[model samples]
Target chain A: MTIVEQPKASGTTGGAAPRGALDAAALRADFPILDQEVNGHRLVYLDSASTSQKPNVVIDAVSAYYREYNANVHRGIYTIGEKATAEYEGARARVARFINAPDSHEIVFTRNATEAINLVAYSWGRANIDRGDAIVLTEMEHHANLVPWQLLVQEKDGDLEFVPISDDGLLRLEVFEVLLHLKPKLVAFTHVSNTLGTINPVRQIADMAHAAGALVLVDGAQAVPHVPVDIEALGVDFYAFSGHKMLAPMGSGALWARRELLEAMPPFLAGGEMIREVHLRRSDWNDIPWKFEAGTPAVGDAIGLGVAADYLTALGMDAVRAHERELVAYALEALPRAVPDIAVYGPMDLDLRGGVIPFNLPDIHPHDVAQILDRYGIAVRAGHHCTMPLHERLDLAATARASFSVFSTNADIDALAAGLVEVERIFRG
Target chain B: MDDLYRDYILEHYRRPHNFGVLDDATTSHEGSNPLCGDRITMQLGIRDGKVAEVAFTGRGCAISQASASLLTDEVKGMSVEAAAAYRADELLDLLGIDISPARLKCAMLSLETLDAALADLDASASPAAVAAEEPA
Candidate 1:
């Protein structure tokens, strides 16, 4: 392994806080991976939209569950099994409380947010939607939220309509209101766009969709990590988010739907754990949430996710939001002045966006920009970001996206700005 | 300058050769790098089992466009059989840069599209070749 020498003036720590609210330097220490150097410079991770770096608490929680109580949940009668079952179920309860679900039984654990959306698309979507019915979506949805419904609508001979986004990257609410007249059965959208960081008006959209008699599903994969999300308060029928994006281990996420909706929908996956009794001819399902989770679930990761929720709750989501907003505001102001030809996408107003900043430097492809940034030990994502339709609409093949998390500091954004200068020097010089 | 984005790669990317559609091309194939949305379409005019003319048109990153630019130049006079037998490593070696595994597809996209166009030629040449090309 290559040992990277820490730069003397790396600015790994020591930044003035906006309101003395979030001590990002101290919080960065909690994540062991952030302490290291990359390519002779301090590792500046700006890919939280892909997956977040885990803190020691979440890591320890997962390891403790496996080390102390390693057994299958909801099955064995032994002491270890019972302990495992308690931890697994306890994680479900934590998820319920984290999202403000009406009942713990409404929270169903899946592999990730994608699987959770797929569960609703296949189970609830198949049962309710039929021929000539319409399902509404927005242009900014990640493929996870869009593709499943597309497949369902195609199979059921249903119409899949999309509400367009403006050039400023905000969804056209008036177009959505017009689409609601189609009497669609569902209206699904992302709470926060993974690429543009545009935060949709979830509550208002949900109310409009509800008035139109359409069920709402909010893809909160990007929202729950950076902002305070209350599913019940949003009044959405189904909400999905991933644990890995929230400082927990992968293979853990939750789908919080209405209890009546989950109870009425058929099981997405059928297996031993989800079935109460199985015979050669037929079988009976377990319950609302259990019916959705089949086979051996990711128990340890769920426990780790529970610990992650506790960590976020301790820090408080409002503080996380405030910290990121400060960083993003600094970035939005700094990037344009630092690189004159830089073209940034999404709303200029901070209230209309989140921590993700996707932009393009003049005369440089996003891939080359990313490669050059990698040399400066600044990691950023460069691709279509699984929202190809949005890219097409924006008339861009790809853009360099730098996303922030709780551990992100203004210093990291400074590194990103300096790194783009290097990109300009290398590409245009 | 970075080793991957060498002067030659940048020159080829900025002023690509044979980077327009052939109106009278005999065969054409298009492919896209789904990860980055880099697309390339290769057109070939074959005569007497050799590539009489070749052209390409698409939008992509430096690596992919340069690779396509370099590939059309290399295969202009080569036989269809030689182009079909072209290896991915050979193309990477021609580029003369260390490519990460993630961007290997970008560097090899032109070759894949060229191979597909050659396959299309083979399918059009004989009925037996069409049967052979079909997956079992």
Candidate 2:
């Protein structure tokens, strides 16, 4: 049975299936935050790009863990600990299945996608980057993806090169080809620009990187939450994403690497749970994922993530993709009409992008626009959005962004537009 | 629009203050808040230990621009010492709104730039007097 048939457990799961899949109205009902008013008006949440609101199922699943099976795993022989361990590992299996990885052993739980990317940089990058070598990346990466490689190049004596992006927001393939010819030791790029919402062609990029004799890491933070991902199908060497973006709690994410690649990579941090035996001198590391994990680990958070995955699974990825696409098209069509002075960033066409829309009004500051929207109970993100390098390329100091998700509706966009009208009036005055 | 951090801030934001070169200005400095992509360049026309005129121009969020306008209002006839000692917290308190920690820097970018401008003014004055005393 689809998870919807089960008792409504968490925020991420509840509205995924209407009678079977929950409609927008029903789904919004499950998110407690959506029921409130932001300013004097009804809340119109549009900042899913930063983080999504949880459904009742995702939240209850997290709370349920603390209430039920809250214990340290692996070390304790007690019942609760064993239950926690099973749930945690079960979450790993769920993640492996979600990405269609060959083995659950490849999934390493992390604090967020940032830490996941850092793990690869500190571990594999430290061992591999050599003098005169090059690390190819794109100009569209968030600081999380870019800075790690910059640090790697700094410490390891390699050059960090870039592949340019088009005005339409897609990566330039010809430029990528030229960068590939450099024979970089590794390639890293975001699967989607969290700010611009440009979805990169990961499968093709992965193939090109592999052909160039470079290991590929796709920052999947924006991609994972919007669509279903199959890592084997994409053929990427490493993929990283955050749980919070997918409606799970904060302080949770996973990095999926090929089993052989992870096995060869060194441990990220050396500490408790990750060690098999501890002598004062030298200690042998535990196998695959645990070796990389290093600490007590986020047990409940991991399980909550599993619940999020299950929530997405039951809803069906195609449906989520369709919903977001519809929302994007609606915003693209409607928001501009509402505020004629606005200039949107990223692809004008929805087909080349995810659901984020970053734009600016002619005279009003994005911060003012966002504050005005908040007064109308409409939420949006304003500023650099942790993608300073990309914005620098665009010559934009900052932009206000409105991102959509499954729970978003046409009405929310309408509220957003009405708020934008108010912003224009205020600015014009 | 009458809000303290509202229109006047947007006015300076849209058509920035002192937007061009100030060749005769005693000092000028630029400050950047990389996290939020806020940048400000403050120029001070100083005369005999007082800021005769202060102007700024840059791109950023409303808080940054509003803070810049507020800085101009706060520091324009004040001595370099007073402008240099302008506290980020006091400026934020003037906004009368709670802002996230991530945005605190945006509101202070212009103030920091003003501080740097004051130092540059002090430096420029020291060199001019030394040259004047040296028979040139």
Candidate 3:
């Protein structure tokens, strides 16, 4: 395979020659967190599905926001507030373009993907969803998407249906087709399974759901971080994602909905900055996105997310996708060889899935496997991973997970493979 | 790694203690740390108002399994009051290693589960009778 050079940092256009085909050594330098030692070995971060480590560029951008342009947005007449608002709204525009939303007004800033999903569940779901009206989801949804709907169903007396995944952990779209025939009011699913690493056929699902007159809400928390997504192209009613999963600081996320739908949905949270006018008796809500954002939003995190998006953008989503795909393929091949007893979860085909690798070693608990991996400075997640329903379907109590990002390399997979060997040896002894 | 990953912790994790449902449990409860996904199901056999037998079964990491084993060992033959007050610090101390604050719950799951069972016992019983049986 020909090695493609990593593009130079977008901020430093024409500063130096682009580094050669970003192998482990070159990519490791970009992440400061990977430099440190954990439990005596050099850190091998493999938990990007939970949260990715920020490059120096993203870290500096966040610090720069607080140090230089720290001010309240949308209200201040001063220069600082104006600058802050520009960058903050600029971040919104970047998010809009990143997902190819029709307009910036369609994007609502949120604390994280949890809050994003909650916004839609409360606002649109509360108004439109009714008693016995069905909200369909897949067994593979993370709790962030699942719990809010459960709460809504409890309150509104609605039925929550789950589309089952196949034995291989792929979404059983045949089951989804059956559910769609029932004419559900709304359909919600994860774009990628966080635990199984299955990339859902969301665009196809969206078309089917829309044709059946159901609104679709996609939890893009896992998908957006690993691949390029065009919301307009996907034709979903709402899409939600978190910044922290994409190498930005925590506490940043976005909820994008169509102009008509967002305008129709009620205010999720009602407080200052969200109301157009407030009286003791009643208050008029603000416009589409602001009505949903009640508090002083995560301003700096938003700015940092913009920088993070730019970081990936300069690298090109196609390149990022290609890099992570290679890493996932390497991991899938190496992991089985490293520990033959290991049971790899999710779809067997690399071409059909995202970059998360979840597996279980026989006779060893996932947590024990995770602890052993930690000794080798490999950061992997263990246990049910907030996908208890999916686990129930798979009949597994837990599985160890190693999720990859653009910065991850073949050597990181090698480290995970090596760590698994130690895990097996220790268990065998 | 200088044995920071303790051998005993690994041993218990590989071959967990009280790994199945107790045949004669007088009291039982299930507890889980939703954040880290550690789970424990504790079953107790109480004789004459003391913990005569303590056992637990569930899925978790090393710290949790070790903690359950250590907790069961510590609580055996102790009155409910004595076992309920088992400090979080002492459990880590018994492990002979420094655990992250996030993982502190992982090491304290059994104690918490046991505490909840004790609380249920108190809730179901008369207040005056429960107060009269307090441990010194």
Candidate that beats the other on DockQ, 1 or 2, i.e. the better one: 1
Q: Which candidate leads in DockQ?
A: 1
Q: How would you encode candidate 2's per-residue C-alpha lDDT over A115-216 as one tens digit per residue?
A: 999999999998888888898888888889999888888887889999999877889999899888889888899988998899888899889999989999
Off by over 4 Å in 2: A1-22, B1-20, B77-107, B123-136
Best by TM-score: 1
Angstrom error of the Cα, residue B122, model 3: value is 6.6
Full candidate order by DockQ, most accurate first: 1, 2, 3
Error (Å) of candidate 3 at residue B112 is: 3.9
**lDDT, candidate 1, A77-175, per-residue tens:** 999999999988988877776666669899999879999999999999999999999999999989999999989988999999999999999999999
lDDT by residue (tens digit), candidate 3, A199-271: 8888899999999999999999998777777777788999999999988889998998899998988888889
Scored against the native two-chain complex, candidate 3 gets a DockQ of 0.35
Ranking by lDDT: 1, 3, 2
Instruction: Give the clash count for model 3.
Output: 0
Candidates 1 and 2 compared: the better one by lDDT is 1
Q: lDDT for each of the candidates?
A: 0.88, 0.81, 0.83
lDDT, candidate 1, residue A192? Answer: 98
Regions of model 3 farther than 4 Å from truth? A1-25, A277-282, B2-59, B70-100, B113-136
